[model samples]
Target chain A: MVTAVRAWPRPAGRAPAVLGILCTAVGAAFVASLAVGAFPIGIGRIVEILADMAVPGNASGSFDQDAAVLLSIRLPRAVLAVCTGAGLGMAGAVMQGLFRNPLADPAVIGVSSGAALGAAIAIVGVSLLPTAFRVAGGFLLPGAAFTSAVITTALVYRAGRQDGASGMHSMLLAGIAFNAIAFAGVGTLSFIASDEQLRNLSFWSLGSLGQASRDLVMTSSIAAAVGALLLWRLAPALNALALGAAEAAHLGVDVRGLERRAVLLVALVVGALVAATGVISFVGLVAPHIVRLACGPDHRIVLPGAALFGAALMLAADAVARTVAAPAELPVGVLTTAVGAPFFLGLLLRARRASGL
Target chain B: MRGVLLAACLTLAVTHASAAPPARVVSVGGAVTEMVYALGAGTALVGADSTSIHPSEAGRLPRVGYMRQLSAEGVLSLKPALVLATAEAGPPAVLEQIRGAGVRLERLHVRHSPEAVRENIRTIADALGRGTAGDALLQRFDADWRATRTRIAGLPTRPRVLFVMAHGGAPMVGGRDTAADAMLELAGAANAASGITGYKPLTAEAALAAAPDVILVTDQALEAGGIDALLQRPGLALTPAGRAKRVATMDAVLLLGFGPRLPQAVDELATKVRAW
Candidate 1:
């Protein structure tokens, strides 16, 4: 269930408090994600491990399983969650603003479907790659996914663009068509794939933080940071564009340029995020809405606020995924969708009630 | 011979802890778990993945999750000195993390062949320091395999068999490059679905055209709907196998696991085919 955007009267005075609360929540979730896991590392022990690792030359000869689990397994996974969540959240806010519509997210630009197609191809064709190429096989899936996502977005943009004005309306339609095509491609691959390949493809689609590594986290963090900073800089432009493209143009905002830049930035950031995390749904579509409901529709606060909130939400979901089944972890994406869909439905109902519709 | 023995010891030392067998072991693959139990090291198993359902006792061990999607923390939580996994067990990084935690990790080079079974048993045996037990198991497996080959060689006809795996959706028939195909080949039978590779949904035309003399299904598949229900499907009902009701069902794991019990599986399937 979804509803069209209603410009909530700006709660300008309360924005700072909301941001502060979100920041604190994110910090808490990060600590919790680090401390709780399948292995029973107590909070005190976690803190001690943290302190031990902080000191120079403390890399002990004795392989401490607790420390390895904390550092190698959970820490990178948590960091990846934060980076991916933040990128998806901010991208969602930007898409909602740029399109002047509430429902627009990266999927509206075919990023998710394109990434899925690319990943399916990689999974099925990986054995065909030369041994030398297969040695770096870990990167191949994400690399292909990212490349295809950008290409899909670019094609959609081209198809949507007409005259000099940004055809945001047609872009949405093109995205829908492309998404179907890409998904069909993925379906065909699944039919032809071996059982193992099918398993890999399904796992990739379900999404997990299990594949997280320091390098993946590092790359995602840089991409998310860049997207957030650049998008945050364009917050004022986005704010103006929110008041109808024609009206914003009259007020000296370059409406066409803003739409182009916003779509490109969202594609780049969300592509990288999806490639790393394997199609985590709901965070991008719902995170910004949650922030806007809390602090009103102000891009400046909504951007950072949504990013922090999304990071917190992802950390909490990932924590549950890691611990709920103990040794058998649930896919983090499944947990997010399970929790997010209901919460989103509730939001839609509340919005309808508030609007007296 | 001394040089070979010396090289073996040196290899073992580098891969495993020096001269001492691991006190506790975690088995990640079903076949790996089977070998561990068959080698008389079952008591040493502290944890196993979800696929390790064979041997009954293995099912009682603490589950570490699916073999392919293992968690490092879960495996480490078992506090095992060694982890024995089939080559298929991983997200790769998880395996590396387990190794980094100073655990001896042995990944068997598995394939759908008897040679691989011998190699896996030998590797698992050496890893568990049960070299004598490994030899005995190998001898028993070889004898059974030789007897099976002899029986199949004496057979007059190689029947056409189809392996239909039905679980909820449209039933998929096993084709070329599948473990089912390998099993059929070993059991003095030709695969009816050899035209296609892997598993594909059984089309009415394909099923009728294959004209199998015997239809093979998993025990679990047969449980879902009886042999009558399977044979009643439109495509299957017209086939020679369906007309005669010559359907054989076997435990899916034992049939496809390609582990120590592979000889038993092949022999059983072949005997059933001959009887039909």
Candidate 2:
């Protein structure tokens, strides 16, 4: 069915325009997030509040509580959601191109698991350190996760090499091994943790945006933006790689450099997000696939389109998380699974039918 | 005048005091054990749950297994005449079995309110033939509690606080209706995470949302990532609590245990919050 779909002609510029509309829709949802919550604030109040914040001494009693709520809570959450979503989406797009497989994701490379293990160690092992040594442990977790991810990818790349040539299958197997090892490490940490620590670890491992702050959001967004831009520059090369390494090299693509840069960028984006949020699953896996369905296989359109769609999906999921249980919010990751799993299954079934498999 | 004299004579002839029954005592919970000890009737305690770990000497007594996972065999082994228990003390079946065995079990109410605590103390005292002792202890406890609270009452502002029970992984926080909240209120500090109820896992985002002035946690919990781990948690690092090094650590058992030494814990907490 995928090949059949590929045979169909698509109108020029339609996908980008559709993506533009999706971006606007996501932006509107972001605004809606600012307006709705336990505080009972409306859109008018939200606008007024933003206006007041922008202009000092602008007397607006209508937006006082709304302003406080937005400035203090909603804005940070929305921004974080966008950054996380965009990062995951772009990373997914890059992975799919590099692997020449639509199913490729950040998780397939064990980046999320590695980051989670790092976070768990930071949380569980920091207590044993001296007071002077304790000050660095917080950043150390994420730092460790990033380092581990880079190392893991390097090792994966190395192990996947056959007579100085690497293939998607070898990379996939290495990723599986890395993910299993990281999960085992996390399990060990969980086992030795105190009952209270165990509870906290479980919740953290589930992934949440509850910790998104202005600084965190900014840092994560910047990292993701950088990754997206780099991936955009490498799009034509990625497109060539999709046709197979031998064909791509023959077509003047530096397959090794392309693979290295793409893997590194994915690691950085996934590591930064996971470090901040603790292993939010499925966004990277689903976002690229969804965008591909709408826009087809061209990396030029697929990369940017995935970023916008991914942000929209995550923000919508987060909005659902905040409101579904009212004041007691569910974890953002849980909400994603509840939505993403079904969508994923549907895609799988559709693909099976299309392929006659 | 003669009618008044007849009424006085009748009142004098009618002595209204009756001897109360000695509580057939089966103290079924840890808190109940402490209360029993507070009531000066530790000897009357026929049995206790595994969590009744206070007063040091209470451990030598027979254990009735864990608090929620009660065993009928362990409880019935004591052959308690009357069972005094906290609301949390049971696997309902074990409690029922004990009751079916003709054991008189009184469920002592647990509350976060100061008045409730005093009343519970009095109720336990009354059951143990030491009502006067309960009254006297309460008076002292109340006086000291008020004195400590009053000292901080004059402070210009109260600190917004977050009470973290566990550190590392996901940090669990105390919201409304929790022992941590009750303790914070008594210490004259506001709970940052008051929007929810009970013990909830606070997201880094929610912690940042609360923007606590003081991050309160137990020593053991803080040790997980030490100060670094606390600071590294998304929103926590930028908060006043994280910035000013206003993180306060208290003994976990004393802070949430709600035992005989809570007044002291309150005093210590108030001092820390005031300084913060």
Candidate 3:
């Protein structure tokens, strides 16, 4: 059904304007995210509270609950949401470009499942680990997830290589196979886990931005920013990649080198983001498609456009997650799908109608 | 063990602190909330996590989400003076954020033992400045516990009890180290599935092999699938308990909550098993 709307008109000249509008939408969503939560602080009060933090010696001379909530809880969470969404969106775009398939997303490379298996192991085996590892405590799940994602990516890349040359079909097949294996590993771990540990695993798998902290936001922001920037710079090569690998090679693009860098960069960005937030489904898969359907197949525009749209989408979804249920929050991953799917479907319908399909 | 020591030391630390007792409290664990109510400090509870379902009044309080997946803003919205949580309540980062926001958070150690329950009661009582009430409640609990133990000790034999929780998929049997197992032991009964380390799905062979005299089921599980349906499962019908139709059902929270109601739960189970 989606394939019926595949032929979008190439409006290359409007790229800069679309990117600008997307950037502004992301900014507005970030502000809205901070303004809404279980705690109700008016927009004016939110501005004043944030502005006070910027100034020196502005303690209101009393315990400020609003300021405490706005600063410690909402601010870091919003920042982390933006960083994570940006990373996932950019990685999705790169994967689609590298694979030459519009449906491909970051998960196609085995990141999500690999992370799932790693986190499952950490949850089920934490008690048996030595004190040194046990003492790491809070970092254990995320660290294991990130490490395994990298390992799985490396394995996928190595297995897909034939006599010093990388093949896209082989790589895709390897990823699908690894995903199945990883899922089975997770199932086995679930079978052995204690009740509390099983609850933790389910919560982790459902994803949430509620765990955002200053340290996590700082590190993930840097990683996402670096990865996004590097990928953005490679846009031209990626566009060349769209003309088929053999054709791109004849035109002076090093197909194998580009593929290696793309895979590595996506793994780094996606691994960090997913490790922090758990498995946030739909964003990576849907964000790029929405961008391409709106604009064109040009990677230069699609890459940045998807990242901005993804950031906005996550910010809006997370805000709803924390507010819709009041004090009892829904998982953000659930909200993302609930929010993204209908909106994505609407866009597809419009695309089909416009194409006379 | 470290968590137990930490909770013990924190209890002492709270005892020494002379700060005014909190007027607004948020409780994150089910057991912690029960203790708060038992100490007559329920009036101070402005919010509680989803697990806090007992006392009926706790259900009316604003919910701050599940203990493990807490939202800092949700808890802070109540503007609580103090937050009482089990050591298990956390994604870890949210707890740190709540602390950073200047809320006093006390994490009580929870284990499936009467002593752990007593420690929690003491910790909550001290934190709420209800030490006199705590002492009276402890005395009453000891009396009930001693009486129950004496009654159980006079029994001719300890029944091999199986705990089957069947909310979804295959029914899982509680084994050694589980709260269900500990509760059975406290009730002067042997755990049928003690050979397994924790909870494991009941295979027909394993269920037949266990051959428990009495089966205990959570009220929630019983509600999901009736007692007849449960007994009719694969190898369950072949078990001694199933053939005899001897099943005991109790609220999971009451039997496993490990709070102020621990003695009452033990007394109830001991009575039921002794009668059989």
Candidate 4:
């Protein structure tokens, strides 16, 4: 049935041009994010500062902390927003293509829940370790999150495989099962968590780019970039798999290998995102679906378009998060969902009408 | 010519802005607000965070919600000239944004001690241009501190006290370097949970292993199960505190704020511990 849909003719080249336009628009949103911030810095001042940063800062400082805030806080936050959005979007697009199911999100395969459980354990369980052994900072949370995502993905893939063929239905069901188990794990951590740990868990669960440090932003962005690019490169293979796994195998695609790679890539990208921003839901689901509807079901266009749109949407949401409260922030994760879900439902209705569903 | 004109305008604006220290202050952390009141400049405060629940009037001040969860717009609505916050008083981006809004953001270190309290009073007072008031508060606090030291020096035995943050089956117990730990140490009492540093949720068996002679809690914790029920809880029932009904409650702010009234708080707790 999925292959039947794949045989539906798509106008080539036109989609890529549309995708290029989308990227430029997303790039514009990224610049807009850089311009607006809680800081009293104007667009004029921001332009001067960004230019100044390149010119060795006029050799010695024009006000230190203000410059530090721009360099350290706002820049990284905007960058991370774009990178994390791209990562999640590409991962979602890849997952949907691999599963040949419009409903598949990067998290639907249990990787995100597993990542949350991993983070919960790091935040809560670290207290149990001797102080000397527990290393703190940017690495531990993401490391644990990524590790758990990989482990969970491997588990789901193994479970989904029967008679040397991976079943998308089985993979999704396995994801559901793993997600439940991960929830129980998180529950156990919460049960034993300290007041501080509980606070950490609560804020982290909401997720934000508010904690975007330069190093964290750089590392997460790189990981996300790599994951998105790898998945984007695998676009043709994903497109092949959409023709049903067995039929794709007959068409010279390595069905079993492609499944493993896709899941691994999703885990790496989405897990890094969850680690950084703490489970930003709906962007992955909504971004790619919007792209698919706009550009048709061509994997090549859907893949890159979703990534760009995701970045732009995340940046816009983050801007609202920063300024809506002025001196306080809404977690970007909450804003994305609150804003994205309605638009998504509307788009879904539109898609249903277009497809005569 | 255009560039030079822009520079002149920029410098003039920057100079004028820096010349005036803010008269309208927003205090973000509990301890920082307490110090502002202690410095006798409470009138300067237009707003404070939810954590600033000291001196009854502070509760009446417009709140910015929890210190960790400040709303940027809510805080900005008060139009504070200076926002005094602790190191932990943020979602960093919000604070950064607040700083960017041309507000003087004074973020003080939240050390858990009487010295930190004194320093906080002095710093905030200095900011408010009330150095004389800060000096007077410091001297009086010093005298009280010396008296407490003398009383604590004469103590024959330091009973082990465990500071449990909550009583209704909470796993968390306060350990070293916390305000509770400092209070016990200053009051001539040993913290039973010293083996583990910071607040942690040890297992019921592990918590009982600390073998506390008394359990210290804030009145806020009573909301969970009340003193009677808290005393009867599983791990708590095995402690010497449970056996003798030696659980003592104090105001959370008074116990942990580490503010201007800390020396008095220390004396009161020290006396209670001695009597126990």
Candidate 5:
């Protein structure tokens, strides 16, 4: 990121100012996210609904239809977008810092594919169980996803590690190999699903914020908050690792344990995010890249900055996704990819030029 | 006499109000859309989802996107009075929002059986206040259903049938408790993939073991490279049906819709099954 940004370097003493800008962007983006949707609710109504809901006694009754929509639909969706983006972005930042690989994204460990395959199996394979065990309800898919994430990470760790040490090259290759296998498994699972189940599965895999309920928002927020804390706590260690494992160990860092814990943290955040909203791409990857371009490669600044940037970017993309079709919605994942891919490419090109490659 | 005249005016007003616009109805599923049209309530439709592609007119209607992935504002853009959808309709949040907005959202139950289809006809008909049309549609449905059954009733043997569904990767055969299985039974054919409970990937050994006499596919599958591609599949080509080249195809929506046109689909299927 530094090499690429050499041509257009950020001014000195700009970090604080950039952070301030990102904070404001996320704040304004949050309000804008709530204000604009397929529904015609105005900013005034949204504010009023929130204000009313905030006051304990005023929650009585007759809040109006717009209030229900504002409070029930858009608000929760916006919160989820923020939470998911923050989690993914923070995860991506830490992953790049820890792995010391700029190209590494959130699911670089194959959690997304494993989680997806887990969901597919839950949807289709559960019905084949005996009548006593056949009643895997709404939680089944998400539960399966989380479980599969943990298992896949464990398996990848086992395969990539060699006699008390881990290899980044092997780990990445394992992610790729496991991802392919998981997708193939998903393909097999889709075949066994009833057409209705298939449609629902495909609909979910499309990754919409349309499933935003208050409970899901709250749950996702808590998980993301915990994940952010975990990632933030590891920033110094990550900074050490980014300089190379030998130097980090020389600096008194436990290199092997650090690698294991970092991977574990990535798995947890990726699991929660993927299980809740299906798989989202690039928020984690580009958020960090953009932050590195603005704030330099310090993990302490990079991690939190990426979190804010990712949350803001996700909400903005979600807003576009919500209104572009109006009365119809493109998947949030699709919108994010469209914007993230180009920006990411530009960053890569700049990086390549800076490196004189 | 003045009282009598006022009463008559009230009755006339009610009937005229109902007849004038028939209420702006929005349909979220293909079958519900078809049923609305079948009940002569097609003009009432202000918006429809992407799945509502029957009768050509539905195609011309403003689309609301996929049935399961709806947006309330897009659906409400038409300001519809009645929203007819299937049980499969919605991201659930959008449906709730539409209902919260005070539009009457009717989520008709979908069971993928003949009984459910009848209930669907009655429900859509009742929603549109077209009881007579609904009844007449039911009779045509009954006659067609009976005709299909009767024609194949005296057959010496029911051909073992398989429904192959593949968008990508390995193909799968439809098993029990599926629309394909139900459709096969309705057409008086035995489901070849009966040992399984639902759709699953078919192995070459499994395909060979099923020993299907006839293979049915959707028109979409057929269009995706025709029967040749299906027969050329590594696992399927060795099957008895593939070897004999006994493949038939139907429009995916109509074949699986289980809507007002289900009787037609069943008849079309039975005719193909009777051959060979």
Candidate 6:
């Protein structure tokens, strides 16, 4: 017995203390990201500008420009990073719980690839249509991504189901197939793309947070919040699920319903995130794994903790991405992969070693 | 006696068959279209690819689609007698299909140097059977290029420049063998990213390593992140380029398009490079 990790929901809770620390860390990272840029605005000036904006006409003159820059640009970008990270983290946790495989991620389920294929088709194919039809091309990108994610997930579920039951192995196999098809589609689109279109697609595929508009941030944050809340509700069930499906069933967990809900939740969260920010990889896998190692696999604590940790990680990664090249921003995805690839390899090695493979 | 007569008649027909003016010429690449127009053969043009949007009237011509992903159906529908294309044109299969259809296809060589551009113009003009007009254009262009070169040669020192292609946050710098590199060289400025060949994504470390005195990019790309954002790239802060604040942006098409206006571009670039 793993003692059910009573620290998560005990009368004298330690979860709040952990949450507080994470919040403080996330806040500090946000401030650091804003302050440290090529322009090099001081922390005091940043706060003073922010302070003026909060209370109307507190400070007059040129401070409004600083406030506008911080509020309109950096604030939205930081918020987007946090939301995207939280969404990916929550999706990853849910996926791992549903599949009972620590290796499971949003990418592993083919959601990211599907979204990518959808975006590519929208961007590339729509351009081939007549000029009148081209007016709607902008919406097609995200629309295609969202539609493809939903379709791919539904197909995977259908294909993986055996006697109305889906095992981790079957789901993983289906995901692999989906990813292959999606990638092939993307390749096809790339073949026909113009030099400019190819450049745009390549950049978009690598992922970026530089285009974080206020509307995008708001939509992403809402989607993330909703997804996180849903995951929160499933935490207790997820904990039971870790005990095995049979034991979970005995504990009044409807395994089928839980699986369906978890898959849907993961798909929605991942689809929204990918649609908004392109495919930012590894946050889902890395964040949950870190949280599991730190707090020991208690779903109640792990779910929220993973969300916070993921947000912090993304914020930090984005900050590094923006500041590292100063004027030249590396794609957030590139930075994530540069960090994530090694961590992923280590996870695989650890898993193999533990299994005595 | 009859066999001899038939053979003689066949020989006569073969000898007298003169190549007709391309009744419906379809040009795929923008540079190819410019060359055709410069050769005074725009009257032969029936349709053009999407990028053939220069010379005002070229924009009025029917577009067959993008250069690389050209539709065989769209192109063939134009009923072209000849298709003039660049080496970088098509989805390969489409080009193959057009060739298979027995369309007279001429793939023009993409050139970088002023001399190469002149040679390309001559080759295009000869292909279009307007060699005389082409000779005149070449002479004028060559004179202009030589005069610009002379002005640039008189400069005390050529500044080291980095030509950025596509930049997200980090700069994608042009190196040796690229059109931009050739243009910079022609303008008498040394390319900072000459350590590498062709267009490549420059690592912040590598970018800083080049120690460019002036950062050159297209106007649109500059609009994205601007000077301050470009200067902030991680390892770039330590570079001489970032400190000196030497950044020059020009229109991409004019800077590296290798058209007749290239002399003007070269002269303008020389002026900017020589300023510091």
lDDT of each: 0.86, 0.71, 0.86, 0.78, 0.80, 0.74
lDDT of 1 by residue, A1-357 (tens): 001122324546889999999999999999988988878889898988889989978777776778888888888888888988888889988988888888888799998998998999898888878899999887888899988999999998888887766589998899999999999999999899998888888888888888766687788778878987888766777777777777677667777787788888888898888888898988988899988887788898889987888888899999999888877778889998888778888988998899999
- Please list the residue runs of candidate 1 whose C-alpha ends up more than 4 Å from where it truly belongs after superposition: A1-11, A347-357, B1-19
**Candidate 4 residues B1-276, lDDT tens each?**
446534643553454454333457899888888888887667667789888989887997776767887755457657677899987776665676667656788888788777777777777877766677789988999998898889779988989888888744544788876779988988889999998767777567765898888888888887767778777768888877778878887888888878788888888887765567
Assess candidate 6 and give its lDDT: 0.74
lDDT of 5 by residue, B102-131 (tens): 788788977877788889898888777777
Q: Which ten residues in a row have the lowest lDDT in candidate 6 chain A?
A: A1-10
Q: Candidate 6 falls in which docking quality class? A: incorrect
**What digit string (tens of lDDT, one per residue) describes model 4 on residues A1-357?**
244434545658568777878888888988888777655667777777777888873736345544655666678888899998888888888888887878789877888888988899888877677876664544677778878887887888788766676577788888888889999999888766755677778888888887655676788899999888888877776777777877777767767777778888888888877877887888898888888777778787888889998998899999899877655567788999998989989988988898898
Per-residue lDDT tens digits for candidate 3, residues A1-357, read 122123324546777788889999999999889988888789899989978888979868987878888887898889989988888988999999999998899888898899999899888989889989787677778888888888888888888866544488899999999999999999999988988899999999999998867777777788888988998866777777788887677667778888889999999999888888899999988889988887787887889998999999999999999988878789999999999999999999999999899
Measured against the true two-chain complex, the DockQ scores of the candidates, in the order shown, are 0.57, 0.02, 0.59, 0.20, 0.42, 0.02
Docking level for model 1? medium
Ordering by lDDT = 1, 3, 5, 4, 6, 2
Docking class of 3: medium
Off by over 4 Å in 5: A1-12, A54-60, A126-136, A154-188, A254-257, A351-357, B1-22, B76-81, B92-104, B154-157, B160-173, B192-215, B220-247
What is the Cα-based lDDT of residue B230 in candidate 6? 73
Worst 10-residue stretch by lDDT in candidate 2 chain A? A1-10
Could you tell which candidate, 1 or 6, scores higher by DockQ?
1
Ranked by lDDT, the better of candidates 1 and 5 is 1
Candidate 3 vs candidate 4: the TM-score winner is 3
The digit string of per-residue lDDT tens for model 6 on B109-142 reads 7767776677778767767666677889888898
Best by DockQ: 3
lDDT of candidate 5 over A229-257, digit per residue (tens): 88787777777677787777766777778
